[model samples]
Target: MSTNNIGPKRLVVGAHYGLKEWIIQRITAVVMVVFTIVLLVAYLISGGASYEAWAGLFSNQLMKLLTFLTFLSLFYHAWIGIRDIWMDYIKPVGIRLTLQTLTVLWLVACAAYAAEILWKV
Candidate 1:
């Protein structure tokens, strides 16, 4: 006969991406900050709010590549955050899947649009 009381046997589970996602999010944030600072410095030194000034800034090959990288980082950061929101609040599997699909489609479309704009400029 064994009599040891444990409160209803706890179960612990996880998808195991918590720390990885957290670290990636921080890295993405730093990338965005650096991009913003670069843009700000360019703007200040250029000393013009004209469309031509801005166009010249992004017309450089290095600037274009950096801008694309920033775009990618921003999209990935948003995806992780939004996915977390959907996972935490939405309980129904079908509804969650639908939201996730919509989010992915929207993000992809935005990426395509960004590509078009970046290349055009």
Candidate 2:
């Protein structure tokens, strides 16, 4: 086959991008671990078993900050994973571009919404 007609090598290129995704996944995983541990410890210390107690805890500034970070990291991690899947499986260039665009927009929207809610809290 002529080199000109050789379609982009799928799995090889996919793996190239996968390395970056792998790093992002690991970083996000670490963030999640720390966030989970801290959140659990905070909850345990608060002993806020009731709904109102939990609400109060969430209303606190520090807790709100932590919550925002937790959600943001989660959204980012999910976005990266889904994007990788799309890049690997979606072979059509136009469709892949559109999906990637939508993914980024969604992530930004989610992050903005989280920030707004956290700010209000």
Candidate 3:
């Protein structure tokens, strides 16, 4: 039998999100954790859980900026995780793309709303 029937060999490479997403997930998680710790420490030191106390914690511009950054990290982390799920499970390209777009829009809207609220406070 002749061995020339097969076409040229092709190499298939996936989108390779392992390391990048892993690192990002960890970094975002750490950011959230650190924020939580900071918030906790402030709350503990203040010894008051009233609305006034909460208001005081966020009165500082630096704390507001840090809060915004933590939220940004949170949204991005969620996006990466959701994108991976769509890439892995959703078979149809069109549906996956549509869902991904919707997800992004939703996240962006939420982020914008968050920013507005953060500033308003």
Candidate 4:
């Protein structure tokens, strides 16, 4: 019995990447929680019974900043999840690469558009 004849050795070692991913996910989760709470509170305060009221809430500088941050974090988290899925299940190298590239481009475009709109607020 020999190691070489058994199989290729695992290249990944230590917990650095896993730990980083976990930390990022948790931090984004917290941001989402806070953003949701604040958004709900603002909506409740505004009553949301009229379009004007909702518009007024969104027009605030603080609200715009929070909205931008929330979207950014959400986009990043989604990108990470999609990348992980592609790496885990996609067997074909060319197909996986294409999917990953498209995913990244789509996410980036959406994030940029969201940021631009937020900036106008």
Which candidate ranks first by lDDT, i.e. highest?
Answer: 3
- Give all candidates' CA lDDT scores: 0.91, 0.81, 0.92, 0.85
Q: Which is the better candidate, 2 or 3, if ranked by lDDT?
A: 3
Candidate 3 residue 4 Cα shift, in angstroms, is 15
Candidate 4: where are CA atoms >4 Å away? 1-14
Q: What is the lDDT of residue 54 in candidate 1?
A: 93
- For model 2, what is the error of residue 118's alpha carbon versus the real structure, in angstroms, after optimal superposition? 1.0
TM-score of 3: 0.86
Lowest summed lDDT over 10 consecutive residues: which window, candidate 1? 3-12
lDDT (tens digit, per residue) of candidate 4 on 22-96: 789889889999999997888788777687886788788888888889898898889889989999999999999
Q: With candidate 2 superimposed using the best TM-score fit, by how many Å does residue 108's alpha carbon deviate from the native?
A: 0.7
Best by TM-score: 1
Put down candidate 1 lDDT per residue, 1-121, tens digits, no spaces.
6644555554545747599999999999999999999999999999978999999898998998899889988998999999999999999999999999999999988888888999998
The local lDDT score (0 to 100) that residue 39 gets in candidate 1 is 93
Model 3 accuracy (lDDT, Cα): 0.92
Candidate 3 residue spans exceeding 4 A from truth: 1-16
* RMSD, candidate 4, Å: 3.8
